[model samples]
Target: MQANSLDDLAAGLARNRIAGLVADLRLDGLHSKAEAAAVQTAALDAYADDFAGYVLVGTSELSRRGLGLSSPIFAPLADRALFGDGWRIHLPQGMIGAQCELAFTLGRAYPERGESIDRHSAADAILACQPAIGLLGRRVRPGTESELAAIADFALHVATVCGPLVEPADKDSLDRAVMTARIDGKTVVTAKAGTILGHPLEALVWLAQKLARHNRQLNAGDVVTIGSCAPILQVLPGQHLTVEFEMIGTASCWFD
Candidate 1:
């Protein structure tokens, strides 16, 4: 993509995000994954001051197959959009979805940019794990945009609600941890944590490697939500959603 086109795409995405409006973006010029990442970075610059970390999407084999993605994609998470459990969330003016996830908060920075990171190393950097609910929405309408366009538009991340942090005695147990999501008091979906890229740590390792390749690294105090454990649940106004993780705890939020 040309520099001007790149800037235009980023600007339009940023505008839609700020206004909480959905748009049909012109993504024909977006050709490569690198270009899509560039557009994402440029668009996120509008909210750089509040940048929290990243939220990885399509981490599960099932999600990858459903989305026709070979690998996972991620988007920046804004601190302003983060909330503690039981918070009342203001719904955006469009269709929205929610996912139950395990989120890790980094205690220290990962190895310097370009340095190798493994599952073990990634595990050592985590301070604690928390049950989380990822609220998802898109700037572009479904079926009208490509994956690249979705990436540039913040990977459909709208907000995140996190439960209390829990320091685990056996981190491996998280791999088999069960997660159940309830919407309006009805069980909607249930799955294991390992469903995310075999193991959640693997997802972290992948994120570290991907960022290092782009000359970035996970830093201290960063909160990264690996991926959804259960199927994405549709969210509606006046609905109450709760996600419980066997290893972590439970996170709940109300849409208003």
Candidate 2:
């Protein structure tokens, strides 16, 4: 698609996103990952001043297969969508789901693009790890759009709620940590931290490398939420959700 047409598509997607309306099938015009990414960038550029960080989605094999995607995709995290623990999120129209995750806050800026960043380097840059819940919603109806269309729709990100930060111990200890999610105090799902691409830090490394490819780098004080550790649970209004990480802390929210 031409750049002007891509921009128009992005604008429509952004409008649908803000209005909580389903997008038309014209989103299928996105032909390649590059075009999808361009649309994503253009759509988010309108809110660049509110940009906080990025969310890496489809990091796990299960989620990737479920989404019919061959690799992971990322979306820009808006500052307005970030909340602290125990926040009450006003329920919006449309289907929504929550995923338990581990979030890393950066202590310092990452090296400029072209520099290599391994797990060790990635680990050293973290300020703390916290339990988090990522709220997801789709702007396009299921089975009605291609994966590229989903990418252009902001990777289904709705909001993120983070709990108290905890300084992490050794990487091995983190790998063994368990994550559990509860809805209305009933256990819904559980998973190990290693389930996130073998280690949560690997998610950081992956983000760093991926960002570098686009000449972008993580800034100090940015919070990056890795992929979900436990299975995503569909949530409803008037319901409460809590996620606890064995070594990290716990985070909760209410939909109302």
Candidate 3:
């Protein structure tokens, strides 16, 4: 093996040892749990998504980490990119579900890899808003998981499905956009554009600050999905769902 590859492997093994030891320690106290979780996140940073220039993340309260993004990002996730083409959507069978969210495709890259930016500046960096579905799945054993570990685990992320793009709107006007979802030809969920932490731009701004802490940044061609506008809905096999960002565009996906 190449020297660097071997070094990475060795480092991953070491990080896993440290995280596993911490995970197995007594964790009833708040500080203990948080400490272990922080270790896990560090291990995750050491190992996952080591190849990509950057990874996508969510900015929603739906995240258990309370960080607005899934635990497992920066990995080779299965998210697919396409327009609002309903035909291309697919979901894992069983308990896998979907969360409708507003995602952005960046046109402008940030100045530094890890530098904080405010909501207004973050908004200026967005190229377009795309209808998005944050695919959800969980595999961690219940008693063994902590919020920090969950974040380290890519926030229990499955994949992200994106639909067609809509031109950016002034924050105030965009706030009025209506959004809805239909499952199996029946409307099951509804919401408004403002539902995402009051505004999707806020999510982006939040992500920027978090990434800056880690010495990371959102760049051009990267996807930044905000939180769901409403509670996530369980999708059944053979179900077709369409999420329309009124006055913006309609994006579709399905369970198979």
Clashing residue pairs, backbone N/CA/C < 3 A, model 3? 60-68, 70-155, 71-151, 71-154, 71-155, 72-153, 72-154, 72-155, 83-164, 84-164
Model 2 residue 208 CA deviation in Å: 0.7
Reference-based lDDT, residue 173, model 1:
68
Best by lDDT: 1
True-vs-predicted CA distance for residue 191, candidate 3, Å: 1.1
Candidates in descending lDDT order = 1, 2, 3
> Candidate 1 or 2, higher lDDT?
1
What lDDT does candidate 2 reach at residue 26? 67
Candidate 1, number of clashes: 0
Distance from true location, Cα of 109 in model 3, Å: 1.5
Q: How displaced is residue 55 in candidate 3, in Å?
A: 8.0
Which residue pairs collide in model 2, if any?
Answer: none
Query: Candidate 1, residues 72-159: lDDT per residue as tens digits?
Result: 8898898887889899987775445787888999998996544569978888888998999988777765564577876777776788
Candidate 1: where are CA atoms >4 Å away?
65-68, 94-96, 112-116
TM-score of each: 0.93, 0.93, 0.69
